[model samples]
Target: MGREIYFGQQELTLKLTGITRFFAIRRKVTMPYSTIKEVLVSDFEAPKWMIRAPGTSIAPLNIYEGSFNYGDEWYFLSFERKEPVVIITLEGHSKYRYVVFAMDNPTKTAAEIRRHLHEVV
Candidate 1:
């Protein structure tokens, strides 16, 4: 019941409850491990040109939620810091081509996801 990514038995679940979802501008997302194609973690400073529509985007505060078009692909971004974030590339009939989420420990989160992905493969 804490604010952490839950790697479920069949899918990856990100919990977004209470005020965190509104301020953070994100909803709880669950994606099957089978859909994951790649996972990358890196330091990300919010870009000035990220247009948020139909989705939430508060660039000045470094808070982005919802979906944005980038590189001709739609990405789901949920974060509020200029620190390490995990970018997950997904395939198949998923809602987004990529998903970006900030983690307290991006490196650890990425590793956990990678481990689960490998097990599924």
Candidate 2:
């Protein structure tokens, strides 16, 4: 197994294991960097349906979820897979409604977790 990489909150210390085959994921939904603005961060939790995404079919999702409020912004973390499947959820208000920035881009280095936050925040 390769070194674990994450796309969500570091305080949660979420880790993924079966990403040995992760490089094959498509490009539209995969990248090394992205960014969302005016994130709400809270409100959305780890959705149960995510276990069905592109990842291990036998192991249940081990994503960790948490939320923190900063000023009027709420930051939510749905710690999805560690490599091939970490869920980085960024909540933001769009057109006067709440939206979840769930278009996560894998392939990032382990040291690039901050870039993930930048993609979502």
User: Over the stretch 25-62, how does candidate 2's per-residue lDDT look in tens digits?
Assistant: 21112222333323232323434433232323222554
Residue lDDT tens for model 1, 28-82: 7778888888899986665566556446676777767666876556677777776
Worst 10 residues of 1 by lDDT: 45-54
* lDDT of model number 1: 0.74
- Kindly report the root-mean-square deviation of model 2 from the true structure over all alpha carbons: 11.5
Q: Among all windows of ten consecutive residues in candidate 2, which has the lowest summed lDDT?
A: 94-103
Question: lDDT winner among the candidates?
Answer: 1
lDDT over C-alpha atoms for residue 89 of model 2: 40
TM-score, candidate number 1:
0.80
